[model samples]
Target: MNKRLNSVMARVAAAGWLIAAMLSAETVTARAEAVVAPADGYGFSVGAPMTWMSRAEADGELDAAARTGASWLRVFIDWSRVEPMPGAYNWGYVDHWINGALARGIRVLGLIGYSPDWARAPGVYFTGPPTDPAVFASFVTTVVQRYGDRVANWEIWNEPNLPLFWGYLGDRAAGYTELLKAAYPAVKAVQPGSTVIAGGLSPAFAPDAPPTFVAEMYDRGAKGFFDAMAMHPYVFPHGLEADTLNGWSDVERVRQLMVANGDGDKKIWMTEMGAPTSAPTAEGVSQQEQAKQILDGLRRAAQTPYSGPAFIFSIRDSDTANQDNREDNFGALVTTDWQPKLAASALAR
Candidate 1:
């Protein structure tokens, strides 16, 4: 009887030690995450599209971004503009803009998308998905081959779930997944070190809406294609803190989706996020409030373990591009002339 009791006590003690070890491991992991927290990791999207910016203007914007503590610049590669004809290509504009930004010490996130006229179906917008995945893949190969050494990060397309961007492709995850599959390999073949980031996804409302588009991508085995995922948690009008259209917690939801698909290891970058100060909507906030929300959102993102660099949209206001356009107004951080906004002062390195 005593031998039996001794054996049971030994088993219990072994179980207790295992529990203690697990607790210790969890604590260690938590500490690691805390250490890596990007509390002050700030970046911004220059409002001007890369396609139209001249070399001088591009340099000024890059300088401004570097001065403002921005380490990363997100700009559209615009396949339509770069490759206007079937085989003819105009590498002049992009080459100048990219090289200029890099010279300013700002890392560029080359957003490659928008179908060239020859690559698109009839009556569809230029932003629509390409008619043939091969055409898009070829464009990807060319851009990466040209700038692969200087640019390490490449975001494939932008907001594919939105109607404005992908109305031609529809919300068919398989369609976008196919594009990703094609483009990912093309990038890898040219620049093996290049990081292929899934396009920044927009926050969509319904349950089976935009967010599901990501789940669909995973379902189609897109996990193996890219290095990281991207998102645009605009959460505008609603204070950056408020969970508008459920966007406030989009980072969390996206993480959960990644975990469920066995992709919990991947990082989610906020490629675009900001609240507008003017052109009031039902949920609009004042200019001062916009500044406050920007800080709060950055703090919140920093605390998240899986969150990567958060790029606030628009380093400067776009007064010339339809001043009343709310999106144009989203850039209240500075005037079109580069005058500082309240939010500009709040952005510390």
Candidate 2:
């Protein structure tokens, strides 16, 4: 009888432990699901000026972003500006943007790149790849440790496939892969829950298109280095469905490549997508067309199963007066004077 009682007690304890373990697993799954599903479906790029704006101006911009129903804001965590020298650092600008966005209930995707003069070789552009991946990784680790509590998503670089950004030397894909490999692990080590995104690939042709570049990254062992891939699919002067090379359609090809490489479970973030209303010559579109294309891109991204948040190129125009420079007019949601554009109304709907 004593032996039988002991056996029964042991079985009961085992059952209780098993039930608790099951509950723990379920809880983890629930949390993961919540993390993946963003509160707002899309985000907006507030441009590079967030670092320099006065608190009042930054608040106003963030208010405008929130009004558009954006739950995320893509801002640059520019290394050159933040850490101009080896040990010198500036957090004033970064703090204003990150805290302001959070105050408005918007999450931040911190795009980290641009080598400071000290970090790169002499005569190299600030946008050039760092002379040492470890140096860049150290900067990344420091940034993550500083803002990891508030900013969980980090992009390693921006448009590295382009010579203008990555410098005109070495293999672009190989060099970028090394940077990602270094930065991703550094970020993860500091904050295990952080999501390290590959630099947003620019829409280019031939040897530099997003699909081709992504494939090359994979070839250079880029897989598993990032939680998600990013693309700047700016199909300007063309509709979302237009059959043009290096257009929005390339996103699918990139996705297909990811799937083939057993990374289908990951997402592809449309980090920048928009058209300039006052673009140069044939590249410019009417305000109405800009609104339509942006809306269509947002809807398509939201509906796609493997897509991450789609961030419009800008929340407001950098300069509406600069009609010849397409870069200044990508802001379809708001004008520089704090006025809402047609796309803003459509987005609110």
Candidate 3:
């Protein structure tokens, strides 16, 4: 009787454990299902900034981008690159890319940020946050006034969360919010119907960065500032089908945060997402894997109900090609010869 009683207790404990595991899995499945519905309005569009293309080469590259089903193109209107001096501006170069893309029937997302030497922190790089928000806002006004007629969508910066871009290295979202607060109204003042998107936040470990940085932006009164939020959900070194529990799937996590903040009506753009196809590194995948990931990434974004336009990092690999450099190979869609990459062909279909 004692042996039988012990066996019954063990069975009961095992059943309880099994039931708990099943419930936990059901919760995860429900969360994943929440993001799988097709998004409205824009759905999914593929495109990248062909920034490195020569002025003469832009038309051809853009033509190729259209062939691959890219409906929108992204280009940087770098403040330092466009306004090298305090008062002077260079409109010819950027005009060429924007006009060429528009002529090809593709819309554009113009990224405008980065400080000129005059405005940057002394002895540091221009990618650093500017010393004055007024100076940065003035630059924003000038750019929008000139190109606002053509470029309806503008991204305030690239990746403010990373030290490489924001450059302050410590809690900088407050500073960025100030910049965005200044720029957003200035942008709307020029192009009332325009959509001003926050800079694409890269997945960084910093406190005031992606995942958490977004929440901070709202806390700092960033609600009415921009029309949409952007993020770079690059899941390199991992397959596209990798588990969502990992940081990469935090794109959905961000959506949850948006809903909680009463901004669920707004869309989240996956501004940059890709895996490099170079020699294996901490974040690099194989060439064949690159092709698969690109397609899978597109499908995932398209199915997510809150997602907007998704741009692959680039249209062509940088000219300085290196087998060992993963950054040089993120463009698995094209070869150095301008020929189609395995991923590019796959995306075309």
Candidate 4:
């Protein structure tokens, strides 16, 4: 998540919203129910920018993704991008990516989230919670009605426990629970078999740690709303077994919390996990180290019966030139010029 790309997408989403509002007055239609099978293996995230890529570029990227033997692809079904205004939708962008992935034999874990300008809470950033949870639910309803047949897994939001993604407003866990409570039933109503994953909790400390935040969600009555818990246990420079706070080990705490809350049967899906290879910073790891950490994380998750499909953060570098920005270097499969990285071959095996 590059803020600059986010800003650019926000503007583009706003423009699409305006255009849809002007040209259409269509209301959401009910769709026949369908069963969506669960994902059986791990995959890579191509990120949100795929919605904006040229056909040749997007296909090339998906071609690379297919070569890695990925069974799933995590795509952002950004609410802001789809519906900028109430009852208005522009689905061309999302349709292309989702349909393309399906064609390539890849199932999609649609990460549906973010608020448009009209729906966002006043004075908060674009990532803020919506003014009304029902409005967000309605958006979820529309999404499921349209893409539920193809996209089986739906993640409620992106890292709601972190202020960077969810603005510092009211209680973060409570706010997120409201969205999940509203969305869970809506997705079920549209597609009863779909897997509604809780927002992937980011690795953080203090009140926002995975354990603490999950406890807060359960306390706020969030247990039954999701079929699985999602986490982004990115312990970059550190190995997957690192003992430090906010590292991959904390996921065990979250699982224990879930069992304590009487939801022990549910699995924890590692939706985003990867290490950047940028130099001169403690956070950066060597390309070989990056591959090793990611492979270890995936193997650990796979061996845990209570853990579901794990996805690497991205497929290719967003910008290799930005040596200082770690986010731009999380791509495990390729460099900015589409050259294969060490992790690409490692993952393919």
Candidate 5:
């Protein structure tokens, strides 16, 4: 072969090799991009405090909630609400909400709290925490039987550490633990696979977060009473940053408790965390940025190994609570005349 012809053949071979290399790189990049990533942060669920559901019938609220980027809805069940009168249980309101929510693909986490005045021992909050734990257990069992198939996650009470939620009980742990001791077994007996979520203490340094809360459970020769931990890390507007959420002592508070109790693998479900979104307050995540904070916090939580799900503190404003009500404004989404706020729209699923 002549030198020029040989050189031309060699150039063609090199060009083909270069083309093949480029094609391989492109394929690899495409493959890498194609791999589906898991949900680092889950979609937030809206909670409907018992107060809201108590006043009126459950309506398009569930649908509106589903649209607000929430895959779950927290509905607190008052033993009073369903069985407000002894021996005569009324399931009207609950039936409407649960069936409606499920029909629309919204998961419900039932928060079961406070005994009815009728069921309570006289003088326990004008009536009392059931004097007989078994009676409370029976109450829990009846509830489980009624809605067990529809609801998977059940919270024992709300902010058991707070006096208001506990009906001004002085002994938070003993009071809550006594109720749980009976309630948990009753619930499990009826629904063996049910997730019994111990109510979280309202985030406070006050009462110093009872050292024996979880410790005593273990100390009493108890083995893992709960499948997951519930935390009410109320990250106010100013404290919604990733660092702030990550820095909270609640993480370590429960983490050590779990490890000490030999339930290190147990997960954490942030039952409630929220902030106001009215305009842009000086100390809070603004309406505009609230969305950003939620998206960021959710993503961070998803990335955490043992984190389960988070239910934002509320759906609508509580009319019953007073203006000093920090809770009145914590409805991650607010409604007036059936219209949703921009923050709610931004986080739409």
Candidate 6:
């Protein structure tokens, strides 16, 4: 249930940085027990792709993700894939994915989101939010129950703070709090001990940018909504604004709301965070620069309060132009295929 961010010196996979996690950094010994995961202790989780794991050479890729350091494994379990048809369920994908990670001695962080067509759209959760709360609830309950004992943490959604995710103008869709309202109890009732984490949030440059996600959730009465929380607090190189300075980029600005809602005791997790190895666009940070960005934030995550483990967004280059569905190259100092970048070696500490 509890993991010690026991390993300190994580190596840089290659030349760039997969910047994430947040801390003001003092000293980090190469492979030293992470100063971030709370002396109370939480282990670092290595992120990997489902498609990659299905490959014959997946073992080598998994090994590379853990090359620097990681105690748990992070994977996205999409609703769209898990239950492609309404009422019909499939555990084949999640089972295989988690089993593979476990075989490597890694724990699992299962993310749940992106409702299936049967669940409908323009409504309750992710891009195509569920129309019926009960339908979504059934999905969550089934998945959590199946992996209840195996996986301790389950995230509800991804990048839930934007118009594309939680923010919807048509009929004021995505009703942020409602998604949790339905999911929290459903997931917990099946696995009372499992941690129902908030959907990962996106931290933009302008402190008070578009959604004001935290404020909206709190206003909608999001008190006691989750166990450990999460954020995507990704700021541009060397940029920190008040709203973007919670503990990490994803959970940005939400900590205060948690406190306001009388849930300060709950911890914060960075489900998605990383600096790309290369700029998918001309304005973005380079892949090499991303490696450094990751080190900066990760040090902070290990050292700060309300801070937990900061998992890099990706293990390899996913797409080009991270923005606009571009690849953004948010690896932890290496290319997606295990090519070593500058920061990769640095992070490998």
Candidate 2 clashing pairs, residues 3+ apart or interchain: none
Residue 83, model 6, lDDT = 83
Q: Which runs of model 6 end up more than 4 angstroms from their true locations?
A: 1-53, 122-126, 166-174, 205-211, 237-252, 319-328
lDDT, residue 10, model 3: 38
Highest TM-score scorer: 4
Q: 61, model 4: CA deviation in Å? A: 1.5
Per-residue lDDT for 154-255 in model 2, tens only?
A: 998989988888866658999999999999999999999988899698888878888888899999999989999888878777777783646567888999
TM-score between model 6 and native: 0.77
Candidate numbers, best lDDT first, in rank order: 4, 2, 1, 3, 5, 6
Write one digit per residue (lDDT tens) for candidate 4, span 62-88. 666676678888888888878888778
Using lDDT as the measure, name the better of candidate 1 and candidate 6. 1
Candidate 6 lDDT, 1-349, residue by residue in tens: 1111211112232222333211213212322332234333223333335633443334444555555556656777878877889767776657776786777677788888777776776444446567776777788888887888789788887766655664352422136578888999998788878888885776554433323666666677666777877776565544343323343533534666677778888888766656554534433565445654555567666666777666766665554434543343555534544454444454453
Candidate 5 TM-score to native: 0.77
Please list the residue runs of candidate 2 whose C-alpha ends up more than 4 Å from where it truly belongs after superposition. 1-40, 243-245, 279-282
TM-score of each: 0.83, 0.86, 0.82, 0.86, 0.77, 0.77
The digit string of per-residue lDDT tens for model 1 on 26-126 reads 23322212222255366777633556754544554555556556677787788888789987888887777677677777778888988877888988887
Residue pairs in clash, model 5: 40-302, 69-349, 124-127, 124-128
TM-score of 3: 0.82
Between 3 and 4, whose TM-score is larger?
4
Residue 73 lDDT in candidate 3: 77
Question: Where's the lowest-lDDT run of ten residues in candidate 6?
Answer: 1-10
The lDDT, on a scale of 0 to 1, for candidate 2 is 0.77
